[model samples]
Target: MSTITYYLDMQRPEQIIGKPLPADLSVVECQHKQYQLNRFLYQLVGEPWQWTDKLSWSDAQWRALIEQPGHRTWVAYYQGAVAGYYELLRDAEGVVEILYFGLAEAFFGQGFGGPLLTQALQSAWAWPGTTRVWVHTCSLDHPSALANYQARGLRIYREEVEAEAP
Candidate 1:
């Protein structure tokens, strides 16, 4: 199988500003919980990336990744259950990357994605000296992924097609 991936970027501070969080939604910073992080990723990304192979990372690797400096993960709660989450990484050069962002399959289309993304962008922009914020999405991602980014003012800067092993 093959997929087309779009690389989107936002360099100006204006682009990173996002709407306020909805009344019932709240975001909590996840801390030192590799198992919970991995489980959340699997639940949110497993369906969209089904054509690709499953993720296989040891617990230690997961811990290392999550514990790295400048790496931040936020989980969204809707009246108490896990609804969605996003991870942000800020490099020394002041570039903030939205490494992963998604709503759980069960929470899709219930007005969660936008607010989640808004909070993610807001968090990214809050970092001192942050000059760029970016993320990548593929054809294999949710159908609304591309549109949502565009709607939030991220511009498509590059795109490419690649084959995926079955």
Candidate 2:
């Protein structure tokens, strides 16, 4: 098997198509750098998609990433329940990357992906000195993941395919 990774980017905030969040769904930035919370969210929303890069990370490793000055997390709540989340990281070059994004297993197919992604893009652009916003998604992700990113005005800048060992 092979995994295909697509790199996408938006040169300007105006490029975003922007979707309005549903009344019952709201997203808010996590004001605290709680590694445990981020770890929980990673496992919760990434389970079905096979996200395992951080599965073996130690507490210190998680803390280091979460505590980075340019790292930020935002969670989406649906009717007061944790529905989804996204993480943004800005480099010194003024580029913001949507490092992680997804809906919880219980929230899939509920029309929340687009709006949540819109929030991600908007929030990325809101960062001071943001010159570009970007993200990457692979074939192992949700089928609509790439579509949703494109619908939000992110254009494909690169792609890669890697063979998976059995």
lDDT of 2 at 111: 97
How high is the lDDT of residue 86 in model 2? 98
lDDT of 2 by residue, 1-166 (tens): 8999999999999999989999999899999889999999999999999899999999999999999999999999988899999999999999999999999999999999999999999999989899999999999899999999999999999999999988
lDDT of 1 by residue, 49-113 (tens): 57234256666766677778888888898888878888898899999999888887878889778
- Residue 53, model 1: lDDT of 44
**Estimated TM-score per prediction?**
0.87, 0.97
Q: Poorest 10 consecutive residues of model 2 by lDDT? A: 26-35
Residue 128 lDDT in candidate 2:
88
Q: How many steric clashes between backbone atoms does each model show?
A: 0, 0
Cα lDDT, model 2, residue 10: 98
Q: What is the C-alpha lDDT of each candidate?
A: 0.81, 0.96
